[model samples]
Target: MFNRRQLLGAGAALVSTAAWSKTANAGLPEAAIMETAATQPPLHPQSGPDYNPVVTLNGWTLPFRMNNGVKEFHLVAEPVEREVAEGMTAYLWGYNGQSPGPTIEAVEGDRIRIFVTNKLPEHTSVHWHGLILPSGMDGVSGLSHPGIPTGKTFVYEFDLVKSGTFMYHPHADEMVQMAMGMMGMFIVHPKDPNFRRVDRDFLIMLNAFDIDPGMYVPKVMTMLDFSLWGWNSRVFPGIDPLPIGKGERARIRVGNLTMTNHPIHMHGYDFAVTCTDGGWVKPEAQWPEVSIDIPVGAMRAFEFDAIYEGDWAIHCHKSHHTMNAMGHDVPTFVGADKRNLTKKIRNLQPEYMPMGTAGMADMGVMEMELPDNTIPMMTGWGPHGPLEMGGMFSVVKVREGLTPGDYSDPGWYQNPPGTQAYEWTGELPEPRKAADAQTQITPRPGSHNTAG
Candidate 1:
């Protein structure tokens, strides 16, 4: 997860360079850059209309300055080294300093000026996805305006006519650029603070990468078989846990930039989809859901009251999405008898172990040797035992009694007496063989019909 919006919101410089003098906008603001990947505190409104800030999980907000009546921000699109997990890293193209670039937040009707400096090797342009603006500022290269040539800065001035969840990415060479992790979340708060407000607001951009083991850059050619699925360019347990106050209301806005859909499921509470990229869903139109299926290139905002206090899981329901670096072509050995093969393989290498006879859960607890800069297929140690999980996974740590704006992890939730599930040692009935059955009516366990 990314951190240090404070560095920009409060300080605004991780070695920011001088604005390009060749550009038209002479008074462009300094392009704030993030240097770390820790989840920093939310940037409260230093100026402009006051609305509750959103916490970008493993990410940060792009800082802006008030120039005249318009809010100004600088976005430098360049190469960045993003840590996908503890041992893995990827060199990707993104805005500012990280892949799935720093979030952009503004009000409903504020006039905004964004200076985009292309530090990339090739021509680039930033497309404001899902924003209402004039044709010239739409950022569609060759259609609205030409790409900002390398080492040049271009200004995009537009008015935020409406408020909703949105996204941003490159329009020029979109396939290669987006596949290399060039995307970000754009959240526009309502002009009126009380219009669908929540105590804790959070954002997550679902992204994926297809980097091979020991590689530094993602392989852009790979399509649906991404090896790593991430939230804001970070995998779990690298993804920061959402710390929620016991009785406070919370909102989670998720934007999917991947090639496929992801059904985000949250344990312990049923929420309602309050908003989308199109607009806010009316209160009467909201429907209760424990899991919301977000389609490709779309966004969904769900809200709920943090009633039950627990270390509830919030992750994609697709099983493969939870395993890191586990490729699609790995041969299945669930029912194959590898005992004989293991003997032959062990003769050549004494440490070779045949797995997946019963299941692959052993991979989570076993500390086997792996390649450098490679995340395990299944990892993470929980309070009980190994989590046996990996990508697109995070915990919502809800606890009682703490600071009102505390976003720190509350550790694992403690279950009350006799509340946790325990092992059962009781015996069950035995199965009768087909030979022992008299006249069988239907086929049952260990029992079959006489006629095929």
Candidate 2:
């Protein structure tokens, strides 16, 4: 198994260095860089909570909890908010009013019945992504049947055909409804008698969002502005802190329902990709890959043998998303000084800043300059400006060694830094430029830089 984060870090370093040297030697004007920056809009702002719906299986009602603090999944076909960038208070759709929906855990052969109530003011339906069900039960609104109208209820009955990680979300108006926060994770366990040896299992749902109701009204989506992102809803670091033991072999099932592909990066361990949407791969197909590119509408399962002990940052590989507030503008840099007048100043108080922009508002919502040897440990991924959007993200802490203990309170595990406090230390790392000297350079056939 290859640790996904380490491999990607190395690849990014190499590519960045190559790009830098090529541009530097070409003597491109500085204006080119500025022009590129100006053409690029800031990252989107993400908000809302995970979806935690109550399910009735075999006449038993079980409440599925969101891994973090996600509250609901708002499913609407029409535009509820009048604008895109403003007035978009963190109102979202959820499983029982939570984002990331609920985590459904079931054993093989169990028949599960889920009742989905549509509270939004429009029509919608739930598509169980990656599940091998009959097409009529696929829940694609028009394709499956007329969608569940507002104030009506629909029954979703299905058997656990296979055992693995799966997901659910509205298939109609997918781009907008999903963007508005309507999705969740569903899991099925193995039925084999020999498959009961696992210690701990977890589910991670990746998502993204856009806008800051506190700073500005949410903006309407033009073709160019829909790029705001999140993971499970909030950008990483801002969503919730994930804690794990130092030396535990954890089985993590990851699902991606966002619009783009995510190279989910986990630190300190190389794990085996044991299963995919089509189910477990053959023994030969199971190999080591650090960063697996999970395209939209796909899922994967892997077991990582945690070897190192430290607080590690896990997120997407897209550099812009990893650094700031879903790529939105940092309030401090936008107009902090001018907006600091009495009444507005109260709004500018440190506590008033939105999720990702606390404390470091004065540094400007752009790239941060840091020492060469310093490696930033980030909690969330997004831009430093408004429309704070990115997709499902989180962190993983691998302890040095494991001890026998209960599932919830495994001893020797330390909570991540900044769990109790929120602070904006500085600007996020800039996308590596194409002209930096630290980049790796390959020698030409007759160049003098070649070394034996």
Candidate 3:
């Protein structure tokens, strides 16, 4: 195998040889490369309105340019290295950089022009989920339009007539493409900025993966038995917390593309579903909820006041969705007699030990070896103890002095004196046993005599 320096030299030599051969074959003094007509001119300056960009954890918004009064944004679909969780990385195909690509924020009434460059080995198309547009630009890949060929560019132009939380993904070979993590959120801010103002806005995409142990790519065929559940392609410990100002109105927009529904639960606030992909929900029709279930292929936007200041948990209510790399085939060992089996196994392996014969909670915090590129079923260190939680979990940090535009992590919260939950240290009182049933129930003598 060649070392780094040797590989660099070899790559340079190959490039130089290729260039010389191309020039010689052309019979020209120098190789001439012509630009294609599809390569449009650089965008020009515009005096159009812009939306208040929301901070998406492990994601970002695409910047747009005004090209002759049209909002132009570019998306490149290609392979990317995504950190699925701490110490676990997956090879995925996404737009620009990360899986669950950058958010696209726009204002209503803007003439939007999006250029999609396909860099995948296979053909793909971008479907603007829940967006109103011309049928030709629907990006259905052979149904509404032809698929964007590999190494080719396709431009989608349309007028944004409605404003709501939307999503985008590939319609061509969706199963394989989406399984490899190709998706993003699209937010069209209302033209009237103050119509529904929010101090802080956040967005997260719910997705799952079935990348087995020691595997780099996800098994696209595995649908119902996904192991790696996450928000924005990131597990609990890998996800960033949502920072907001206390007493400020906040909005969280979530889009689900996974096979399962996620009942998103929040610790400290009761939020109302304010908007859907279709449109806004009227105030009278809205109800307060601590958890909201988001179905697959749907988007929901919830809003609430950050009245309590602390590190509040926000996660999927499904217990399994909160775990990492758990094996479904592992046998239930609880209450099983393994003393003789352990001795026989250790005689051959010298280090085999029987575990989970009682319960599985200890495995959450146990220090055990795991397969390469695989995360623990539960892992995270908390102030109190091992959090023993992973996947689809994060915190909402509400601080007293945070600014509306501030996106920096405020760090862990500090509770007031004697406020945090702690174990009771006082002496326990003796338990009062219930009186015997025979002593408590006294039958009448006359009734017993009559019965006899």
Best by TM-score: 1
Higher-lDDT candidate of 2 and 3 = 3
Instruction: Output the lDDT of residue 254, model 2.
Output: 67
Error of 2 at 418 (Å): 25
Per-residue lDDT tens digits for candidate 2, residues 1-452, read 11223322332332223221222422211100010000011111122211121121101112321112321111222222211111122456554434555355555665655556676777788998878777888999898978888876665666667876678889877766776767776766677634522444555566555453243222334322333455544443343434445555566666777656778777666778888877877768888877777877888877775666655556677755553334344344321233334346455553343222234433333344433322122332322233222234444545544442322222233446765346769898876656876765444355542111
lDDT at 18 for candidate 3?
A: 23
Query: What lDDT score belongs to each candidate, Candidate 1 first?
Result: 0.86, 0.49, 0.78
TM-score attained by model 2 = 0.58
Best by lDDT: 1
Q: Name the regions of candidate 2 deviating beyond 4 angstroms.
A: 1-89, 193-197, 212-228, 326-393, 400-452
- Give a tens-digit lDDT track for model 1, residues 1-452: 22353554333442243443443454567666787777767887866689998999988888777756777788899999888888888899998888989899999999988889899999999889999999999999999999999998888999999999999999999899999999998888999999998999999999988988888798888879889989999998899999998899999999999999999999999999999999999999999999999999999999999989889999999998998986777777765668778888889999996777668999988888888888899899899999999999999988888577888777888999798999978996796657755766443576522210
Could you estimate the TM-score for every candidate?
0.91, 0.58, 0.83
- In order of TM-score, best first, we have 1, 3, 2
Candidate 3: clashing pairs of residues:
none
lDDT of 1 at 450: 26
